[model samples]
Target: MSRRSILRIAAWPWLIASLAVLVIGFREAIFLTPADAAQGDIGRIFYYHVPSAMLSLVFPYVNFLASLAFLYWRRRDPLKALAADALALAAAEVAIVYTTVCLLTGMLWGRATWGIWWTWDYRLTAELLLWLLYVAYLAVRRYSATGQTQTIAAVLSIFAAIDVPINFMSIRWWRTQHPAPVFFGGPDSGMDKTMLPAFLWNFAGWALWGTFILIFRYVLERRRQAAEQEAALVAIEASLEISQ
Candidate 1:
């Protein structure tokens, strides 16, 4: 099969999987999952909130690797560089979307648990800062020129990756009630039996969904780059003809 044919075939499973996750998995998570004893009905938000927050933490690391690949491309392969930039951009965009959801859901979760819309807790504060960093990275890409945009984006993504672990660890290092890493506490923390399966299902679903989104975004970016390259070639030929 041609490359185009191969891509189309490969995308079929992702398409079906995405639809399944969206239609069946999402409803099951929201409606069927039992409420936490402590948090009550509001705990349903966990399906979206926890996944988005975790994804936000991870996506930047993907971007960081892609950015590095883009920056030091020894082969000077435009396609490789393009793939890296495209993936990085996709990861950043999805991370931003997921982060926004995370923040909103977190606030709602907090309101139920703490009776407040926001908190200055260490982990929350650091995550908020990380959100700002991704926003800045997007803005930098938008406002800067081609090569410069890539350079700055790479640097920002790398920096953002460094911040993720710090944000994750902040709650433990400082005194806070962010509920530790485990959802129902730790191994000895006594979790509700039913909740774990739902959480794990949703986590796997999000991982699959995130990959689909990044791949789709990468294809779009590649098309745009290809068009620009064609335009540049056309312009060069036009200038040469004019000189002749």
Candidate 2:
């Protein structure tokens, strides 16, 4: 099959699967899940909140790795460098989306649980810094000229990866107002039986959704690159014709 034909075939299945998972996950999260004894229905947000936070961290790491690949191959291999740059762009864009969602959901959850809209706590601060770093990364890609943008952004991405560990460990290492880890917080950390299933389902669903978005974005980036190359070729041919 032609590449376009293959993409068409693959796209529909991915869209359908993503929609099905998200819808089912939403239903389970909002209806099937029991309310937290302490937080009530407000706790339902955890289903989305946790998954977004998880993906926010995960995608940036993906970007970091892509950036490293770009840096290593950028001089020796143009095709590999282009591929890596495209992946880095895709991953960074998706990571920013997830991080935005994570921050917004976190603020909403905070209001519900802590009776405040925002705080400058350790984890929150670190996460905000992480978000800002990626925003800057995207800005450099979007606003800067093409020649040095990828290299500079790749270096920034490598530095930005440092925040991921700090954000993850903030709750454990510092006296923060944020809640303790539920998954790996030792014996004291556990979820209610009723909440666990919904949380897991939502987590899986969001993960799949994130993956789909990354793939879709990467495809779009590749198409854009192809168009640019075609346009450049046309411009070169026109210049040669005029010079003749």
Candidate 3:
């Protein structure tokens, strides 16, 4: 079998496993976990929202790193650059999807818990900025008129990565509307041990699912690149034959 075929085949089992984990996590969150004392059942949104937010933050780093690789290898090793570009594109698209889910779920949770869909809090606004950065990255790749589109997007990715630290530190630096860090907000930061299993399961599930998507997308992009190269070769050959 071809490499792409193998990669495509491999993705299925990972998808299945992630789906299984997601179902188990959903069950644990909805049926097993008790309601929060302060927030009540609306707090269950934590399972979905928190995981999505974490992944949204993570995939951008993937895009940023891949973009850096693309920039380094673009001229030195064109094939490697194509692969890196494929990975970067895949990562950015995935980042956008996860960030959208994060924002939507946050809004839903906010509406339920805070009685408002959004506020200009540090964390909320920082996360929004993060989302917009990736959207612009994709837009640049999609619509930029310049031949240096990838280079432009790669530069933009560096700036996009800068926002990640700000978004992460937003809650830590200034506790406005958003809550403080759950893992490191001093002695009383962590969740209950009983809540750990559901949280852990959801985190794992979403992460695996996201990886499967990234790989699947990379494969598709590689195939497209191959097709474009083939078309260009055919056109070149036809032109040469006509001249002869």
Candidate 4:
């Protein structure tokens, strides 16, 4: 199958599996797992909030790496570079989706737990910055009519990439209003084992869901690129015929 038409999305395997996993996760999160003794049902937001936040951090790297691949191949192999650019664009879009969820859910959780919708905590601020950078990247691609739009976005993505580690490390490095690390911060960190199944299942479900989204978007972008190229070619051919 052609790269432009190879994605047989009519029967997406990941989509069904992700939905199933998400159903199971929802059950576990809402019915199976015990509520936080202190926070009650509000704590359940962790299942969605944490997974989206983690995946948000991850997809930026995918964007970053794909952007790098785009740069490397833009001159070497145009087709490969186009594919990379599509992937980069798709990843950036999905990153926005997940990070938006992260920020919104976090505010929901924060308001319920902390009685405020937002704080300029290090982690929160860093995450917001990461979101803004990707937003800028997309804005540049969408609005910049220059042929160098992709190149500028690619370079901008590098700066965006630098923030992933910073955002991840913010909580670790500072005593912020955000909660401490749940897994790797000394002996006192980590949730009850009973909570693990819900967290893990939701994490798996969302990861699969994110993957499905990324692939679907990438395929759509490739098709779009293909269409645009065909249109440009047709225009060029029509111009040549007129000149002839």
Candidate 5:
């Protein structure tokens, strides 16, 4: 079978697996997991909120690395550069989706726990900035001239990645309305033992879902590139016939 055929077939299993895992994780998180002593039932939002936020960062880093590879290989190896560019675009789009979820869930959780839906604190501000930067990245990629779009978008992706670190470190670096880190915030930070399993299941499930989305996006991008190339060839041939 052709490579495209194989990829199309492979995507189905990944999609099914991701859906199954996410459904199970949702059940475990919402029904099986114990509520927090402090935040009560509202704390249940943590299961989905945290995982989405974490993956938001994860995929932006993926985009940055892919952008770096694109920049390095762009002149020397067109095929490698194209693959890297496609991966960068796919990662950026997926990251935006995750970040949107993170922001909305965070707002809802904040309203429940903090009595407010929005704040200009370090973490919140940084997270908003992260989202805006990537939205701009997508706009640039979408609107720039074909010859320059990939290079410009790659540069933007790399620079925009600086916001990821700021978003991650904001809680540690500055006091905020957001809760302190539960997993890696030194000796005083941790989650309840009972909640760990649910969290892990959700994290694994979301990670798989993100991977499937990324792959699907990459495949679509490859097809788009192929279509563009075909259109360009057709235009060139028509122009040659006209000149003859």
Candidate 6:
């Protein structure tokens, strides 16, 4: 089958799965999960907040791999490069959304626990920097023309990848103020077993959605490139006819 057909096939599964995940995740986070002993109902934000924050961290790494694939091995594997470009754009967009969710949830969680909306704590600062970088990368892509977008975006993606680690480490290294990790094995690691499955389900759902978005964007890019090639060919033909 053709590339376009393959992309179409890939898209639908993700769309369906993403919808299911959203519905299930919403139900579980708000109504199903039990409240934390410490933060009460507000702790419910973890269902959304942790996944969003983790995925935001994860997407940049995806973008970094894509950038490397495009810049280096692309001559032998052009599809890899194109796929990488598509993934970068998709991942970046998703990261923005997830990061926004993280910030919002963090604020709500904070009000319940810390009684403040904003703080210069390590995790928060690092997350804020990450959000800024994503915005900058997107802005750079927008200002660039079609011919330049991929290369510039690839460079930006590479740089953006660095922020993920910084966000992860800021609290560990500095001990500046934010509470330690909670989910995996941090200070507040005693999680209700029920919450674990919910976390995994939501993570899987967001991941599937992110992958679907990437593939869709890549197909669009391919079509755009094909159109440009066709236009060039037409211009060449017109020139030849005029010459004759």
**Winner by lDDT:** 4
Write the residue-wise lDDT of candidate 2 on 169-244 in tens digits.
Answer: 8999998899999879779997888777788778888888888888888888988999999999999999999999
RMSD of each: 2.2, 1.3, 1.1, 1.5, 1.4, 2.7
TM-score versus the correct structure, for each prediction: 0.91, 0.96, 0.97, 0.96, 0.95, 0.85
Candidate 6 has which clashing residue pairs, if any?
Answer: none
Overall lDDT per candidate, in order of appearance: 0.81, 0.90, 0.92, 0.93, 0.91, 0.77
Ranking of all candidate structures by their lDDT, best first: 4, 3, 5, 2, 1, 6
On TM-score, who's better, 4 or 5? 4
lDDT of 5 at 215: 90
Model 5 scores a TM of 0.95
Positional deviation of residue 88's Cα in model 2 after best superposition, in angstroms: 0.5
Predicted structure 6: lDDT = 0.77
Candidate 6, 71-174: lDDT as tens digits: 87567787677666666776677778778888988888887778899898888988998888888888877786677677777887766787788888787678
Candidate 3 stretches greater than 4 Å from native = none
RMSD of 5: 1.4
Comparing candidate 4 with candidate 6, which one achieves the higher lDDT? Answer: 4
lDDT of 4 by residue, 1-244 (tens): 6543445754366688999999999999999999999999999999999999999989998998999999999999999999999999999999999999999999999999999999999999999999999899999999998999889999888987899889888889889999998878788999999999999999999999898899888988988999999999999999999999
Ranking by TM-score: 3, 4, 2, 5, 1, 6
Clashing pairs in 3: none
Question: How much is 177 displaced in model 3, in angstroms?
Answer: 1.1
Q: Which stretches of candidate 1 lie over 4 Å from their true place?
A: 183-190
Model 1 CA RMSD to the hidden true structure, in angstroms: 2.2
